[model samples]
Target: MSDDEFTPRLGKSKGEDGKRLVKYGGRVLAAARLAGSKTGVLTRRFDGSRIGRGASIGRLLSSRDRLAGFRARRAIVKTRLVRMAGNGFAAARAHLRYIQRDGVTREGAPGALYGRETDLADGKEFLERCRDDRHQFRFIVSAEDGAEYPDLKPYIRRLMAQAEHDLGTRLDWVAVDHFNTDQPHTHVMLRGVDDRGKNLVIAREYIAHGFRERAAELATLDLGPRTDREIQQRLRRDVEQERLTAIDRRLLRRMDAARITSPAHNDPFQQAVATGRLRKLGAMGLAANLGAGRWRLADGLEDTLRRMGERGDIIRLMQRELTARRLERAPADRVIEGELNAPIIGRVIQRGFSDEHRDRHYLIVDGIDGRVHHLDIGRAAATEPTPEGAIVRIAPRSASARDVDRTIAEIARENGGRYSVALHLRHDPSASQAFAETHVRRLEAMRRAGAVERLSDGGWDIAADHVERAAAFETRQLRDRPVAIEMLSAAPLERLHGADAATWLDHAIASSEPLVLRDAGFGRDLRDALAARRQWLVEQELAEAEGGGVRMKRNAIALLQRRELLRVAGEIGSELGKDYVEAADGARIEGRLTRRLELTSGRHALVERSREFTLVPWRPVMERHVGKPVAGIMRSEGIHWQLGRGRGGPQIS
Candidate 1:
């Protein structure tokens, strides 16, 4: 690839002849997967030129006649490429792969550009030459970040111009207008022949191989006494040094003036809209707000606001909530006042929450004393308040229920029928029995081998032989299991006295379904993915390393699943674990532990890792819960969720 691949689009529209004018909107979508010919089963074509959407870009320019002639010339070149090669996706992929490998034409075909086709006769000859080519190649180059992101495009353009200058020819830009995804990528196409039908040769894998060195080389150079003031100077000098054309300068100026449109700092919509304003509208907002400050408010945003009576910057969220509604949800034709959420309650609504985050179903209460509180809707929905016995933990997914019941029963027996025993009334009786079986096997072996004795009341009376047997069993199991499987094998057990599965969770971080981050800009996709993964990590009680930044240890994950530990390495507070994982991708499926046993040292014996496909570093958490949350501890406010009329973030620890 010269510096990029050729991803050209051919379109046309009526020249404001106002009558059915059409023009080409250029660009194509491209994806590449090497070794595997098929992109995936969902893909429509094998050779790979599939245009899912055919809305042409030429329609806009048809409404403006001034740019017609220039567009026509470009359209002609595009048509020729379409005839000889494939559609945008295939051509773009081929071009990108070719450029990276340094595409160079040998004998046949007119070069990607055609200045020599001055006459109809020569153009016909040129088309013939292009059609006869036998070999095709690919190249790829990417700015590890993105071309449109902070200070990257200018650097890339310089590289392209250098390649063009070195080859003594203008590089054909084919993939510039690819429309679908905002990858900030491009493809340039070329042939061995130049405008004169002479031979052309270009380097291969040039982008990654060449630019890798180039980026480093540029990183050096003591631009001396660097400071914030010097940054602008360097940028200006770089643009000028590369001899940017007047058109390029105009584009950069327009981009520099663009504004963003969201609460998130790196909003993709802001970026996408800037591109549209640049390509279609010609200009955008003034410089975007980078510093911490207020957003110019829109209308109709007050419907969601309510005072939580906590202390933080959330007081200002009401204004933003109102503004967003006016911009996105309110009927555009109707002019409205402060949004529905903006109450007269003298506080700034600064907590930026979504409509869903704010849209909670209220309990619809009739309160005395003229006061109202939302109360936890989830808990209220599932639980009935009663003047009854206290709540306790249950472990049915574990085998401990049986052992626990036995312990309680024996205690009762020893007391000679004092108080009735009820250990977590809801856990299935079978699960409790299963838990006892696991412990019983080890105990029976020790007694039979003359190493220990079982008390008449079912307690262990052990000796050295019993200890020796446990040590042997644990060592054998560890040696047999691969490191990763052994790490993820045990499932965490949580004993919730009377609480159902749903009520015991940290509702903010735990959910049954997946979600997509929504945004008009492309970042919405990434944001959602990150949020879900982050939630999972948090629920697993896995926090990033503390001050020392230790690599999360594997053993900690096992301990958490075993429910023997709660808090991971550096986080505060221990917690009960409710975790489950497959031993390997194709290994035996993991069923809920209807038969339970305490997950402790020497357990996890049944998890099997296949002889092949070694498990890599699997995702797991290390949590050690000493006991449930201390009463009155402020709830976590990290998650933005709704409970009745209220919306709040989990309080930070």
Candidate 2:
């Protein structure tokens, strides 16, 4: 049956929707029972009450047909297990014990015993291989009020009888359950497990054929006329169905190579950078130490680093004024040739800016500065755009993962649900649907045991005895307060890489005396140029519970590690390139994955199963172009610049 039909929802209290007076609610509860027993998404309104109804997204269920469904569930699932009896009687007993115990648990009862002792929880090693951590699964069945089915119960019995008689099995009961609501439903927790500890070996199509033979037998008894194929045909729910591309198909073949999203630890900075942090470094000029003694502007150094000081009036007079002033040049003048051009250079280049551009400065200094260092915004550090589906479906951040898990577990546990396992099926129906169904059952079991309280509105409230974080937000909020920043000293900033006592002083003084500070050029040295960074860090620290998160540009991070801040620093004395810091090093490097390449070491990478390439096409970074911008300004002819896959992409050509 299809599980996508909608049914009435009810409450459980007096005037409560679940009571007999509220027939619709009673039906909802019945359907909920079915939902609880199966792994289908149980979507509920996100609130704090039971007023909102919840159900499995896979299929709709109701009250009336639940028991009958249970009968079918019992019989069908039982038939599936009877085949195991051929191995021995222990297998038969194991199946029975598993079904009874598992069945009770599905109906909001405290569960004991992990399946049958003889059968492994998954039924067998091969089965375990096919399933995620938790083997509990519910077939997603969608049912609507108009959905018609012949009296298939008798046929189901016959199928069971045939299985019992043919297999010479001791177990004969049918398996089924019904949600006592309008969208009739049932969850079949079978009576037996295999000696090897598996459910059954029958393919869905094979079962359909057997049911057809039994249907003919039942027709003689005056049962309604419905084909087995009809029953099998009515099973689908909300989920994407697509013929994957050749690339995507190969990717699916290896989706399970990596486990679900959970790791003991990972670095955010490295993750951000490796994932291609951004298409641009943003408004603030990147403080790059080009491995040379100092940073070189794209035009090369017009003035020595020592000469560019805060103490210099000329330094503070014009450049910083334009930057800090944040002049909003008239759009008409975007292209320099007239008023848009600073009188100094008398020309403008139409360097396009991304939508998120902020604090733009578009003017270049002439011979006065020696090198033409055009002040601008947006450091284009681009990476290939992530595709829509799996290839780019990064595992949610750890924090996000923790939140989803905790929220789910908490709601379940509060209702006395025990989430022994959760498997990320990764675009699979079994994992997403049946997994959800079983989870609901566990939560209901907890509810039955008074472990949790289901709110009429939504969400859940746990008993005081079961005090624990049930959701990520709550869990995160519950951590004992972090060490306060007020207790820490402000000095030693010089010891810390980015923070210097001077930068803070400059920022504070700037706030107090902007004019005076600007004239004195007091904001000089490393602190002078990176005044914004210093301010940003201070603000960041103040906002966070602990000290702020410190980060450096990948290039700057590499340069800063050395005693000097220039391209020359990479020399034996400076040790720049030789001792360059990797992304995941203690020092944080934040930037996009501009491009990557493998050296010509002749070392072959591990061959991937994918038909098309998944591994990045890398060659050793052709002559590192750190301080110098490689992709120079391209004169664009048309409105849009087209780029191809390889480095030869038409980028504003």
Candidate 3:
């Protein structure tokens, strides 16, 4: 039979129709078998069957024993998954450096990095390996009894080995054990890639529960199971503690509809502990005795307690820092929480991480307001490092819409809810291109935050409520960076009085408004320093006494700034054997940024060429580019820095 003759058609004979039905049934059966195999594979993968039996077993045991009466050894594990894109690599490098910073060791030396086999691991080599990684995993593991172990290295190694076995893959990781805090802990940085160079995908349950359980298991084995006496002692301590404790968590869990009944316990110690904790809670106004052995939990009890705990920590930190510096202030003079109605001019007493794992930083400031203030300045990278004793101004970051946002909204409204540099310029012909570009940058930031939309044509699809959206975006940013810190002087007040440069005191003198200073702490010192600075300026003929006040010359600030710059430039020129040239406005500056010099005027960068060098205003963005070739135009507001080579380089204003 011919092929065409055998082909099935609508009017085909019964034999052809049977053949077609049989062929179609076979295809359908094959498809069904394939689908069944895929479903089976997915089921095995997700049903805790293929993800290693050890991890599954560990998770089961952890959940089972969580509510058991006996207290096991505890471990706190904080994990963060960081995506390595854009500036992520730089941030990762910074984090590595931060974790291995000095004074983290038991002997007050720098923290030493280690790997699975070696006691000393090269952090740079590890970073090089992680350069091309898609993401990274950072973990901070702290055993409650970590100090019991003579050394934490072995424990950390064993814990990591357990994790590797549970995950069924070799992990590329390094760790550093820090003994600086009361609770000794280890910081582990794991590469995102597995042994076979594949992206490591850990289950959420594993990261959240399995890993901590594994650590706790290792700790329990090393320290032995917590004895009844140890458990009771810890529980008793928690009962009277100001912080959130295990007993509070138990009470919260036992509550029915925000009311908990104090039931008789089989263990008298536990009953006493529970009763004591409830009474403590009542004293703190977190629980109300509803009578009949019942207590009503207050709304926001957890939040209030957490805040109280944080305040207590802040107070302790302030006390420790002040005592170390030999500075004394009354407990009532310490400000833990308050609204900063005005910018605080102060000396930074101490700078440290409030939450080290999250890189949240805080500052203890001896303010000119005559109070010691603890300010949560947010992210570590949000502000430039203001060293201890440096004078700074701390101001609340405004969440309201700025003038740039209003300008963008107005221009977008005029152009049918579309914004671009071209539209901005067209809307206001008098505005400079640089000014218009600022609006585009604002829109770009909002677009990245997902608060606004960007068109394919490189324009923003501005909404009618764009201003409100801008405000909302800033409000979200405030959670990460709540305050703006400006370094007024790198030198202390005592040193700035005799300095030749135009200092913060000079700026204060030039201002029309008078500074309000109290006669205590930093405030008293600042008043004396200002008096000395005014006397020095008068000695230099830059100021004159008039009407019981020191009056600065018409161009006193300019003259002082120029004098200091000249003196510094002369010194730098002598060292490099190169002539010093002053960069004028609109001057094309091309040279390598050699170093940074912090003067009373401001931070300045020394850019050196073959024959000559110039000092330009320094920017934080230039920090990473130090020793690299830099080109910029000195502008009236600031230098427009062209970072990197080629036409597509980033520009910073």
Candidate 4:
């Protein structure tokens, strides 16, 4: 190999002459020694080798000083990694779209996406080529002085070179520079395969510790170690920062159990910075002078500062999303957060990852409350896909099992600690076959999950505390589903008026719930929609003008809802190239999964049972079983899939 080509130097070794070769700074030294030092006392004050105690202390202090400066500059660069697990190519595409989103440059231009081998403008073909890779890796690197440079491509290239040198192989990667935020950052994506066509596995320590250290080293090389003046200036500025800062971290660490902070015990410079921070915190009611150079900290000081920092981040996200959409909101409106007690009915303005590094998601909704709300909706897969302009209602999801759990337990108690579809139908003969089957499906799901015991006869031996166990099971599953989403209308509000189907506007007007419309943007638009629908109702002769108010005919709402369902069914049937088939109460349905279709009423799954098919309420579980055979009983609410993996055939009612 040429001198310029990289080589891996693992360790020292012995030659044929029995000489020890020690590796230092990538060079092998044979029997190396301190050339100028005396045998016992050592003459040189300091050299590249260890000698006397005085020289050792001096060298130690020198190394620490250099390290201190390095650490101070390291804080300026942020490094993060995102692992693309399943459908890596799809993830690669999604990440490219996100990083290259419009207005992500300093000049408000669309981010120019580029990879090592291909420009992002032709990203589709490049991603298709990468489809066979097991996984992809996305990395983000941002420098504190990144904005100082007109373009960040050179710095990114330098960083990647450093990575290649450290990783001991040529890497396959792509990158895009994003400059919209305060920090100009680069998004780098790497194919998971290495130069030898083998899976590239990076150590967790290397990702967490090594990558940032190298990035910081490169940054320091470019920008130079921060001067004492620069460091002091930053420390002074941190005194008044509203969010968590280095000063706050220090204070939290140094405070006594009595809630008192005494910076006098620290270095003179740190004492001054801490005093200034305490004064600033005092102004914010987070600190108080306890006399004698000590200050009393507020209870939950760290938590309060963290929350404030989070709120600031949320505001920035809301503003960035709004600006990208060319929309604006009033500054006076506080961003809603945490668990909401009631559902927010609105049209989805946009949906995207909130924390891309963590795969957490968020939504921007134009709510009926007259405000554009930003909601952090946890994982993206927990909720169904909602296209922009789709009307949806978002409610806080509960971990506890529903009343259905209690109903199943009662049925099991009546049937000798067991429950089955046949037994359920015999006991509740008046109940719709679909409804009874729904209970059986619930039991089947619980049994499959090992939350409840299932007998060989397709029945559950549910205990009195089955609901509690179900809730515990849900909690153990994951904290990914924080919000329950229901699609109210797949079509936009403007297109719903004058249509021959029922719309959300009609229900809002005729329902007993108070019409609380916000008089801004989408809220005002919805108000206009409600008025227009009222007029349409009169024109359709569904209601008559009575004493300055329109009087709807008896069961008009029910009639309109039925009409909407039939119209949706007709459209679905047209899509499937077959007639709409409604499953009878006791009818059994079995078929290969087709696809899921969204309608005005709700989302439905099309199950083709050999030339004929029926639309059933779509369940999330069915997504994995698509294009595979499924068996279930048609129940009142929906079809229950026969997920046969247990003792008796796993069937849903």
Worst 10 residues of 1 by lDDT: 70-79
lDDT of 1 at 185: 34
What TM-score goes with each of the models?
0.17, 0.17, 0.86, 0.69
lDDT per residue for candidate 4 within 516-562, as digits (tens), equals 78888677888788777778999988877778656677777657756
Give the clashing pairs for model 4. 434-635, 434-636, 435-636
Per-candidate count of clashing residue pairs (backbone under 3 Å):
96, 91, 0, 3
Candidate 1: which stretches are off by over 4 Å? 1-130, 133-141, 144-158, 177-183, 195-199, 205-208, 211-653
TM-score comparison, 3 vs 4, better candidate: 3
Q: Report the lDDT tens digits of candidate 2 across residue range 67-177.
A: 232113211221122232222233333333433343233344423222212212333442334332122222212233212344324333444455444333333133332
Candidate 1: tens digits of C-alpha lDDT, residues 242-287: 1222223233433322332323325454334333322321221222
How accurate locally is residue 203 in candidate 4, as Cα lDDT from 0 to 100?
51
Q: Order the candidates by TM-score, highest first — what do you get?
A: 3, 4, 2, 1
Question: Which candidate number would show the highest TM-score if scored against the true structure?
Answer: 3
Model 4: lDDT to the true structure: 0.71
